[model samples]
Target chain A: MIFDTTAIAAMDKLQRVQFATTLPGPKPLCLVGTRSLAGRSNLAPFSSVTHLGSNPILIGMVTRPDTVERHTLRNILETQSWTLNHVTEEFVAQAHQCSARYPEETSEFEATGLTEHHHPSITAPFVLESPIRFALKLEEIIDITSNNTKLVVGRVCFVEIPDESYSPDGTVDISRSLASTALDTYFSIQEVSRLPYAKPAPPTP
Target chain B: MIFDTTAIAAMDKLQRVQFATTLPGPKPLCLVGTRSLAGRSNLAPFSSVTHLGSNPILIGMVTRPDTVERHTLRNILETQSWTLNHVTEEFVAQAHQCSARYPEETSEFEATGLTEHHHPSITAPFVLESPIRFALKLEEIIDITSNNTKLVVGRVCFVEIPDESYSPDGTVDISRSLASTALDTYFSIQEVSRLPYAKPAPPTP
Candidate 1:
């Protein structure tokens, strides 16, 4: 069915949100880890993690004006450090549980029974169960004038990848990673085929 | 293995790009279609399509400083309208071929042999083979100061979703959609589960 602006605006709040969110298709699910300046560790699930650049290895994620993700936003702003851990099927339930509105003192790691590991060099904690992890430092937060949301940009400081998934050509195969859509649906992906780089089709006879 | 920033910086350019890009895991693949004011149509494959907000239903995509995506970006800026079509496995080959650097006068639609259909209310053409398509209008552009890349934000003007894939709860099942990772890898996703809203755990007995 076709839904125009007027039709979308008429949808109930929940329906509108689901429709809008699901329209983007599947997104990479990651558990964002951060620490408050006062020494509190925070964890939350986010599918907004996106690749921004490669030269300096920049990543960007959007944060809404809601309270659920506020702790993560605050901690990243205060400490200027965070970690991104890919959510695999094995631990996706625990990762999803991190979205609960727990108190500031409550660490989702402890609440969900997920192990928290730390590197000596980075202040942020990483999920021990995650197969892929990245230590990042906050680089900038750009505001979306159209909406009140904020885009948090980070610079990758370190990376840990599963040796099994790493390719000789440097690409990491993440078909084993669980992807999420909209607000609640989870999916497991299987690699179909990797094609060669595209070039314009040869001139037709 | 863990690679610190220094180690990442020391890697060759292709290696660094592949490693950094693949680390984010699988991303939603879409064929972005736009029509320049001069009446030339353009389509290109992008995995950066992200849900920015729902109230106004905004979508954001990162455009690199390279020339490949410039045509789509310029058309969106000039015409203030565009279309996003989810790339399905059946036509992903043609969609990926849209990434080929075609001349300004050539429409990726005709070059790739993908049928383009248009709506009476919207000027941008939609991919006839795509199951989910969105008509969007330019909302805002946020620049990443750390890098020279641009974030093009668009407001959803209309959406067309397959009846079979949409659910009563307003979410659309996109497991049938093909997702892409890094630059060349594609995957078919399956719906594993749909989780309920997360709530804080109750006090222990």
Candidate 2:
């Protein structure tokens, strides 16, 4: 069915948000880990992460308006460092719980019973159970004036993944990572095929 | 295995790009459609399309430096409109072929044998074969000075989807759509389960 802006505008706020978020299809899910100046750790689930560039190895994630105290945003800004831990089926429930609102002092790791693993090179801690994780240093914080959202760009300073998951061509086989999608749906993607770099068909004789 | 920034820097440029792009896991693949001022249609495959905000229904895609003539970016900037058609398994090969270098006057739809459908409200054309598509108006163009990339933010003004594919709560069932992922790889995702909103477990009695 076709939905024009008028039809979309007619939708209630919740419906609009749900439609907009889910229509983008499945996104890469991760647990963003950060630490406050006082050493308090914060963990939150985000699906907005996307590759911004490769040369400098940058990744960007959008954070909603800071109408309320946003612990993740605040921590990242204060510490200038954060970690992204890929969510897998083994701890999907625990990862989901990270979204729940908690007091500023309450750490999701403690609340969700997830272990925190500290890397020597970065100040932020990562989820020990997560098979794939990356430590990033804050590069830029773009205030998307269009809405109050903030686009946080981070430089990947460190990465940890199982050796077997890394393909020779540099593609990480996340099929075993058990990536989830949407608000509550979990999925296991099956590889169809990887074709060679596309080229125009040779002219017919 | 763990890889530090120094290690990443040591790798060749090609390996770095491949590792950085794939390490983020699968992305939402789409054939971005646009029309030049002269009315020539252009289609290009992009996996960087990401959800930025829901209020204005904004989506962002990264465009490599316009050092060379980028038809899709040029068209969108000139007309201030574009369409994003989700790439499905059936047309994966054709969609990939759109990435081939085509002159500014050439239409990928004609060259790749894909049909273009025009909508009355939008200047750009949508893929006739795509079950899911979106018409967007240019909202903002963010320049990433760190690496000459452009993040084009578009406000979703119109959307078209098969009636059956949309769920009541706003989730679009992409499984049936056969959405593919990675650089050249395709995948059919299987929904494992949908859990309820996460809340702290009730305190033990």
Candidate 3:
């Protein structure tokens, strides 16, 4: 049977979906800022982080398209750099505390009772409590026409990975990281398995 | 905290994971011709499915760099139109079966025990069992870089959305259809939520 435009259009519409991840992780991120219009510090939990490309090592996350009060967005736009810290299973409670809406001067780390660590190469501050952390610089920002979000693409600059979580190929095993998801609900990544890699190709003709 | 490239790169390499998906969902696709080609099909998946312009109902997908025997590539190239099928939970079984190494003359649809619905608008065959499908014409094919996989942009000739899956905005809810990752791993969409939308800005300030 052959398919025409009619059938093609039908399925395309059905595949559209919306994504909103607001859940906090186990560890809180102390988004340390050296320069901000409002000054001092801010901490927030974001789960939209994703890698877009490898050649340039591009990482992206969706942010408020028209955020009137996105201090993080202001910081990224101002300093053009931001550090991403993963909240492990142990820091879930502390990570949640940093998410509180607070005055710019009120340090979320102090307010949430979490400690902060300075990145060795970059000027941004990181959460010493986070088992995994990475620093990045803003590369490009693409506003998708289909969604009300800004796809913030950045370049990775520096990183700190717990020794226990490291692999030979440089992949992080998620089993022990204590990662969580904000899929309209909270979930943890406990047991992960690797399967045969069906390398991209059709069976030889 | 601000992120630099080094740190960001480290995290991606560290967290790199392998996916296990043989389910019926999006796979590699392309447009090949029946001219001198021994088979009447192409193989590959479209990762860049997007609305080029709603007025004309143009849809596009990027067929990044490939170096293999892909039926989707030749079929679209030989013929102007190709059928885009959505890999569904039900049909992914047969779809994956179609991906097996078979003779060029071997009709994947027939071997996999799946039904292909013919499209009248074009001469392509769509997967009837798929929750979503589309028939499109080759509007353009651009290689992002020399010697890289080409980005096959198609002008949606037609579409099909399941009756129960259609939403109020003419979009269908995909959670019912299930989403898969194209990376080495394929993850079933675990959840879905709503967000108003984000505003946009270009690459340049």
The alpha-carbon deviation from the true structure for residue A138 of candidate 2, after best TM-score superposition, in angstroms, is 0.9
lDDT of 3 by residue, A22-43 (tens): 1011111223333365555566
lDDT of 2 at B17: 75
Model 2 per-residue lDDT tens digits across residues A12-127: 88778778877676677789999999999989988778888887899988898652228999999899999988888788889888887777878999999999999877899899
The ten-residue window of minimal lDDT in model 1 chain B covers: B167-176
- Please tell me what DockQ candidate 2 reaches: 0.69
Q: Candidate 3, after superposition: displacement of residue B55 in Å?
A: 4.7
- Stretches of model 3 off by over 4 angstroms after superposition: A1-195, A199-205, B1-39, B46-60, B93-107, B146-149, B182-184, B195-205
List DockQ, one per candidate, in order.
Answer: 0.84, 0.69, 0.12
Per-residue CA lDDT of model 1 for A19-123, tens digit only, reads: 888988889999999999998888999998899998999999999868589999999889999999998889888988998999988999889999999999999
lDDT over C-alpha atoms for residue B150 of model 1: 90
C-alpha displacement of A16 in model 2, angstroms?
Answer: 1.2
Question: Model 2, stretches more than 4 Å misplaced?
Answer: A67-69, B66-69, B178-182
Flag the better candidate by lDDT, 1 or 2.
1
- In model 1, where do residues sit more than 4 Å from their true spots? none
True contacts kept of 2: 0.68
lDDT tens readout by residue for model 3, B105-134: 666655565665765556777676765666
Residue B178 in candidate 2, Cα distance off native in Å: 4.9
Looking at chain B only, the TM-scores across the models are 0.97, 0.92, 0.68
